[model samples]
Target: MKMDAFAFGITNWAEIDRTEHQGETGMAYWRTRYFGNYPNQIRVRWVEYTPGYRADHWCHKGHVLFCMEGELETTLDDGRKFVLTSGMSYQVGDNAEAHQSYSRSGAKLFIVD
Candidate 1:
């Protein structure tokens, strides 16, 4: 991804408003910040997944994601699956692989896309 022009900044995630996203089986809450303009923007987020959460759709967007607490399982459209636990991270390019996620016991993550 191209890094766009943006000034230095610090974020207090707790001060950001949380938005809810419904999953196939649960819910996800996110605190997000966007930098730069659309199409070249950088999105940074603090996210939480409710227990038994399973993404409702396949995502083709690129991301740099870090697991901060609990666990997350990611499944590719081709059936490949992987797991992430605290301190683990994954990176994927835009349109690289269509993927979805699940969390059986809830999780926290930091993501940039």
Candidate 2:
């Protein structure tokens, strides 16, 4: 798919390129991508968090996430916990919460930001 093209119908992830995303500490790392939702309406990617992985910082960005494999957890600054197992999904509006994610056993998720 063309990077500059408008997002529309189906596009396969297997055919899309990926980039490694780094954090402030680099300990919370994952592969990422963007596109497939029309211009800049939405960005999509698959996140792969290794076992014992967690994000380097609390994030305030919103996302629509679909659990594709394994398990992962999202914690709100207020100590709320949200877990995503295989086939489980979650969503949060951008910058709605000061949250972070962790995976005791790793996880693969379909994410739209």
Candidate 3:
């Protein structure tokens, strides 16, 4: 990824407005901040998943996702599954794989894509 030049800044996630996204089985809330513009923009988010959450679709977009609290399970379309707990993270490239997420006990995460 090419990162265009930009100034450094700090974000107070609590001050950001959260938008809700319905999952297949539960709900997800996200506080997002964007740097640059679409096509080349970087999306940074603070996300929360409710218990029993399951992603509604397979995501082919890449991401750098970090688990901040609780646990999360990510399953690839090919039947591979991986788990993430606090302090754990995963990185994937754009269009590399189609994956979906699930959380049995809910979770908090930081993601950039």
Each candidate: what lDDT? 0.96, 0.73, 0.95
Worst 10 residues of 1 by lDDT: 1-10
lDDT of 3 by residue, 3-108 (tens): 6777899999989999999999999999999897667889999999999999999999999999999999999989999999999999999999999999999999
Clashes per model (N, Cα, C within 3 A): 0, 2, 0
Please tell me which predicted candidate would have the highest lDDT against the true structure: 1
TM-score of each: 0.97, 0.76, 0.97
lDDT of 1 by residue, 1-113 (tens): 77789899999898999999999999999999999888788999999999999999999999999999999999998999999999999999999999999999999999999
Question: Candidate 2 — which pairs collide?
Answer: 7-38, 62-94
Q: Model 2, stretches more than 4 Å misplaced?
A: 1-7, 23-40
Which candidate, 1 or 3, has the higher lDDT?
A: 1
List CA RMSD, all candidates. Answer: 0.7, 4.5, 0.8
User: Candidates sorted by lDDT, descending order?
Assistant: 1, 3, 2
